[model samples]
Target: MPAHRYSELHTIPFYECNVNNRISIPMLINILILASEHQNEKLGVDQLYLIDKYGIGWVVTSYSIHITELPRKDSVVKMTTRGTSYNRYFAFREFWLHDQDGNELVKVESIWVLMNEKTRKITAIDDDVITPYQSEKVRRVPRLPRPGRIEPEDQMTSKEYQVRWSDIDFNGHVNNSRYPEWMLDSLPMDFLDTHEPTNIDIRFENEVKYGNRVTSSVVVDSSDNDKIKTVHEIKSSDVLSASATIVWKENKAEGQD
Candidate 1:
């Protein structure tokens, strides 16, 4: 079977960058999703097509991203995505972001499940769906480092946010990319300024609908002063909606400590 990777070029706009002028994690995810969608469209299996033809849609179950560097505003980067493999109920996808000079800036792996749009039930992935992507069934899919479970004692800070209409996707729920934004916003600005996220792992537990409110909680682990580990939870009406873990490294310029 031929390889099925797809690539797209993007320019990091000013609005996608944070105050520090680096691309925000949430925006990076959005770019990756866009790349994946473009590839799916080429394969005739994009979300809209799936929902229309099969009454099913792809829903992300978990994701892990490793960041080597974040592109600065106005920087040109290439984003690529491909289907790695699949099983009866799950599909594995991989994404990468490369700088103009061909250095990899970000790598991500995600697990997705096909859900029946009308019944909202998990569905088996059809062979025809996987065939176009040239993906094979794998006996064991590679797993990323799992995010630590949150404990009662670890809850350090919490903030509540209302889901806006704009946050709602075609599926009538808050977009998966928005969870990371909510999680990151719960952190102190000082910490965001002093550190940059190097790794992130997130699991989606429940869906948050439009007009619902989500409370994001943050727990910090200071075992290593140089490296910070933060655990996050997004709760809706006191029920867990999603959870995440983010690892950070001190923000320093090239050749600086």
Candidate 2:
């Protein structure tokens, strides 16, 4: 069968950039998510369709993104996405970003699961549902390295965050992209100013709904401070909502990191 894919062009807006004037990691994630939504809409299996027809919604289980070059503000870029494969309860997707000249800048891989809206339990993906995307069924989907386990003693700092209405997505839960924002915010301002993230791997363990208070905890590697791992759980709660490992590189002069 022919590969099913979707592609679109986007201009980097000023709000999406950080102090360095390059596209921020969270914004990159949002763009890739939008691309996936667009593709699903074309295939008639989008959020609205699934929620209305199947009483289910898509929840991202994990994501891994590798950035070769960060797109600068005001630059136009093309993003493409496609459904790779699926099995039982899980589906895989891939995303790519390119410059105007078609030079690849970034690649992302993600895993998603179907959740029953009423029961709040994971449900098996229907063949009729995934068939529209033409995603093949695979024994094992492609994945990136899982985020490292965070030990209790390694916890450095923790901050509590109240989920705002703005953070909620159509599924009535905190958007997946928002987790990166929360994780990055837990870092000191100086660390953020001095270093930039090159690669990020995140795993979502549970859903965080609006009005939930979550605490983001950071754990820096003892051997290398540049490698930071964080875990976020609902405040005063034991449920682990998400965990991420971000590799940072010191920023250099003239837009290099």
Q: Tens digit of lDDT per residue, candidate 2, span 97-197?
A: 99999999998889988899999899998998889878888988876678876676775688889999999976688887778888888888888887777
For model 1, the superposed segments whose C-alpha errors exceed 4 Å read 253-257
Screening candidate 1 with a backbone cut-off below 3 angstroms (N, C-alpha, C), the clashing residue pairs are none
TM-score, one value per model? 0.95, 0.91
Model 2, stretches more than 4 Å misplaced? 222-236, 254-257
Writing each residue's lDDT as its tens digit, candidate 1 over 1-257 gives 75499999999999999888889888998889899888989998888889888999888889999999988889999999889988888888999999989999999999998999989889999997789888868876677667776797675799989999999987798998899999999999888887899999999889999989899999999898778899999999989899999999988762232
How does each model score on lDDT?
0.89, 0.82
Q: Model 2 Cα displacement at 113 (Å)?
A: 1.0
